[model samples]
Target: HVTLVPSHPSYAVISENKRQVRYQAPIHQPLVKVKYFYGVLGSPSITSGKHYWEVDVSNKRDWILGVCVSLKCNEKWNFLRPENYQPKNGYWVIGLRYANNYCASQDAVKYSDFQDSSRSTPSAPWVVPLFMTIFPNRVGVFLDCEACTVSFFDVTNNGFLIYKFSNCHFSYPVFPYFSPMTCELPMTLCSPSS
Candidate 1:
């Protein structure tokens, strides 16, 4: 499963207004990377906490056999420590496409649940919890198992596929996405479409 940590733990508080609601957060850029055994493709497009990339369809779209991505929440993710949460907010989220078409032809692609019971627990069950922090905001994929295809992933809500992985491949595409920034407690996330 993917691990999500807010950019700033405490300061990310949501405020409500009849006409509008605001969630203020200290602005600090997040470091992002996409990784797999195939190797690191490139840095991701950063927007808020979400990232993006394109799998080019120029010449070798069919060579891609499998795909996966890695996300680093931030080192300050430890801010959860004071809150009595596990210290692992960064991890890999792997998505496998066994079928030849693999939803590329379908109007909506659905991924299986993110939790796999067969894998060993990293530290504890409830260490870190947040849909935005864990799953890739969206996953855009284009593939041609025989030729070549460009796949796209958007890790944002309603934007892309959400996946759960059973293993952690932390070598090439792994690094903390954000650095420590002072945060305030008692915060709430604002609904995207609110």
Candidate 2:
């Protein structure tokens, strides 16, 4: 996620309307050992309270939406692989792929299990597959820091709940995540009135 508060992203192009971000091609091997795609994070990260945002995904099929838990990921990894994103890796996100497949990034183990005295391995990614009856034109992301939950709504279907992540341990401030994916379509950030 790009921290607009600090600086703008170099790999993604923001439209003149300032609502859409189209990521550019990958720079030959990035600072990290791997090559990852570009994505954006909204400014003024949420430390508390509830926050909601919507993305216009009417024409997009491959994308990712949710909240990112680690601001440090930008400084450390610079860019992250989608496969590395999980609750344990400081990302609570849902993704769409292959035009129809939907899934949420989950942890193989519970959060509290690691906090115990035993030094076990970190949580592995447990992607839960999701099936939607209707493809939403706009997806609403709601983050409740107090409840430690993030929920996604299908705005096109009377705000129906698509999926929700519970008992999230947000270590850092949460930032709204947007990944338009490598598709030809662009994802637009929706205004409150729209």
Taken over the whole model, the C-alpha lDDT of each candidate is 0.26, 0.73
Q: Which candidate leads in TM-score? A: 2
- Model 1: weakest 10-residue lDDT segment is 56-65
Stretches > 4 Å off in candidate 2: 1-10, 26-35, 76-78, 109-124
- Cα lDDT tens digits, model 1, 156-194, are 435564332323222233321211112121112123322
Give the root-mean-square deviation of each candidate in angstroms: 18.1, 4.9
Estimate, for each residue in 35-79, the C-alpha lDDT of model 2 and write its tens digit.
454566766688998888888887776788788875445664335
> What's model 1's TM-score?
0.21
What is the TM-score of each predicted model, taking all chains together? 0.21, 0.79
Backbone collisions counted per model: 28, 1
lDDT of 2 at 150: 96
Candidate 1: RMSD to truth: 18.1
